[model samples]
Target: MNQSFINTAVLLTAYDPPGPLNCVFFMLTFFLYVFTILANLILILVIYMDSSLHKPMYIFLLNLAVNGLIGCSAVCPNVMDNLLRDAQSISYGGCLLQVLFINVYASSAYAILAVMAYDRYVSICKPLQYHTIVTPSRVKLLLTVVYLIPVTLLSFQVYLTSQLPLCRFVINKLFCDNLSVVKLSCVKSALGDLYGVFIIASLVVLPFFLVLLSYIKILHVSLRASKESQKKALSTCAPHFIVFINFSVSILFSVVYNRHSTVSKYVNHLISAQFIFFPPLLHPLVYGIRTKEIRRSITKIIQRGILAGPL
Candidate 1:
């Protein structure tokens, strides 16, 4: 609808779209995406409205929820559409947009998670100085950088992929991704490949290392303190670790499954679907249940809703 639909030369032909039980799959995926988006949206709303959650940790959590909302929005509708149609394809611009949004989601997750770990470390290891260290201005600056850097990097990726003459247009997966687009390039781009690795290292590996270091420091300080301090630190960090482990493992599986030559199509499809689908759904559950403040906030909102009765 926006600027004529320029169909790409490549078509996305796989989604098991014409398979039997499409209705079942459609309903399942449709509701899942809806629930995922709703949960994250509500989390963002709660954090934004509640003055109690204006601190750096909650801001980072809000960033994560926003990422989930955008990421799920980027991939899920296409998936549900493909489930109902025999021909699954997207426009060239559409495909680039999808890949860019997904990569932005991925890159932002890393940056936000790193910032969160640093927040936790500051709170746990330097409690007296936490306010001085992680002030509101600092949080805003970090948040802006985390979001902006990813968008800029992924935009460059889209530019690189666009320069390539796509000799082939059929992407076999349920949705578009950067790697899939890169493979369609008429010429294998050594520079693009190198830059991609660099981006991955910058966004993924470095962030993971930083988070690890923060946790190490947190652990060191927490163990030396009283049982209450240790429990407090664990409670705060466990939800984040759960999210980190879940996403890292899911992405790892997706990467390996995609790159491997011998994976069954059905299995590859499932893993790929899970990669984009599950994180958004899981985040709210883990944090809403595990984090006491968020849990209490959700509970109060539910109580008020019940008290308000049918509107």
Candidate 2:
């Protein structure tokens, strides 16, 4: 690519159209984006509007839903637009914004999941102190930190990336991912790579262990409780665990796929989309199926909506 044109905009490909199925695949992508957004929105509003759900667990659930919404919005619309059109390009400024949103939301999710695990532990292990520990004000503070840490850390990442001079402008993937954007730089910054590893470890590894620790304590306490209590704890925490595993696998695939560029470009494209596309839909689905309270609330709301509609 011409060096002079690098500053103008970067051409991003959705997936190297591997076959003659571009129209059908893009259509599936568009509908999936729409469905994911709608399902997560429903989940969020159910948690918000239902006064019965105004507790610590549901509060964190709300945060998760919001993360789903913001994260999907960050990357999906751009992907959909690119897939529908003949050309796929994002301006330099817009690309930076995409990188910022994608990282911030993705990072915040780790924090929120950790918080949710802690919420579960307190509720199951220290029932008496659960209310005192996870108060509305405290939850507000936790969410503030969740979003704050990512934005602060990723801003530095973007700053380091911005400092690099780019002579290459083609991004091989669908959206402006942090690693992908950084990879385009003519000279790779050692400091940027170190910071990337640090923040990733901080965001992902630490939180996963924290969640694991909370669950361990929860399991111990749950075992000591009565059979009914054990079942109840399992019912509540199982869904969160499922979501955690689902998301962890997706993040792992993205990390592995990016690190190993020997993977086919079309294959990388599909794998990258899995992380951005699947979790939001999966979060609501897992919670809705596994959590008794959420299921009842959803049913009540849907029945009301249907009853209130025109005959």
Q: Write the per-residue lDDT of candidate 2 for residues 123-183, one digit (tens) a residue.
A: 8888898878888899999988888888999888887777787867888778888777777
* TM of each candidate vs. truth: 0.94, 0.92
lDDT of each: 0.84, 0.83
Per-residue lDDT over 31-129 for candidate 1, one digit per residue giving the tens place of the 0 to 100 score = 999899889989998888778888788889988998898888998888788788878788778888889998898789888989998999999999999
- Which parts of model 2 are misplaced by more than 4 Å? 1-7, 14-20, 261-265, 306-311
Report the C-alpha displacement of residue 96, candidate 2, in angstroms.
1.4
Q: What is the lDDT of residue 151 in candidate 1?
A: 87
- Please give the distance, in angstroms, between residue 59's alpha carbon in candidate 1 and its true position after superposition: 1.5
